[model samples]
Target: MAAQSKIPQATAKRLPLYYRFLNNLQVQGKSRVSSKELSEAVKVDSATIRRDFSYFGALGKKGYGYNVEYLLGFFRKTLDQDETTYVALIGVGNLGTAFLHYNFTKNNNTRIEMAFDADPNKVGQEIGGVPVYHIDDLEERINHVQAAILTVPGAEAQTITERLMESGITGILNFTPARITVPEEVRVHHIDLAVELQSLIYFMKHYPLEIE
Candidate 1:
């Protein structure tokens, strides 16, 4: 079956984890993998892995397993690793600075090409090879990139996102607290690190589960 046919939001989010694990398997010279092995690596239940893989159609036999190289190729094609996604940064604060330095270039497909900030001191500066421009140049600078990472203050997220959409940005990785809205064609992925860490701590405190 076509991968898109089983594109649930939750399952879509898990694709990265699957891809990472599969990549590791390939590097380790693993020829095949099982749902239980994937579950253990990603910390998800085996049944969940099986169900998730089902969307892509029978990936394994009842007793055998999935060919690691086959799954790697499938996910690479699904995630569109063939094309590079240029991303812009909307803020140059601490977290944003960190993102610029360790930008997702290790993945090879995603990269930060430019940055925008309102601070005069930060403008005209280069962070981790990406040049920063004044927010006033947002529309103009962002027009050169297809995606963005928004780490501006909470109050500025919506306004920045609106400008991003107007500038033709097709995807966003939002780190601010605000849930900015965009047209159907644009995709937004919010990463509230604080909230996620808090949730993880809460689970560890109250609902610890065995690794197995």
Candidate 2:
């Protein structure tokens, strides 16, 4: 694996997509796959897939394409698939509860080991086999967690984010629409569902398909 700093952020983000497709190919008893095949499967352009793979230097041959087993092995090591990443979920609202139940079941490497909620009724209860604790124990319970999923109300996003940072949470997957601020050391990825839906509608309106 190349130094992560050398890979473009966009390309780095697509690695998981490639790894997933390769896993599917392997499961289907496919030994090799071309960039075009991978592109079609992952919905990424072939040229873009080639460039992304180029960052890792000769991941596939010109004619032979990529071996499913080899590519999967490479990505498994690169993505640290064997290692488990413990994540904490904040706020056990509807969205948070859904996350706890689903819990990235396909991705074996990541798991929401525990969750936090402000509602007293939900506290000390277990959902989807994950124990829920009070928000007051955020710092104490999150000591071993590397990342967190923030699904609290927009008003509480910033305050809870600060508490998460104070507890040494370096990465946050924020589902709230608050756009909370964080220091350089902390990384936050926002998943604004409304914004995404709006963008999808915009694309549908402006780039409507042409029926043949």
TM-score of each: 0.86, 0.94
Give me the displacement of residue 152 in model 2, in angstroms: 0.7
Candidate 2 TM-score to native = 0.94
lDDT by residue (125-162, candidate 2, tens digit) is 99999999999998888888999999999999999999
**Deviation (Å) of 198 in candidate 1:** 3.9
- True-vs-predicted CA distance for residue 173, candidate 2, Å: 0.7
Clashing residue pairs for model 1: none
**How far in Å is the alpha carbon of 31 misplaced in model 2?**
1.6
Evaluate all candidate structures by whole-model CA lDDT and list the values in order: 0.85, 0.89
Off by over 4 Å in 2: 210-212
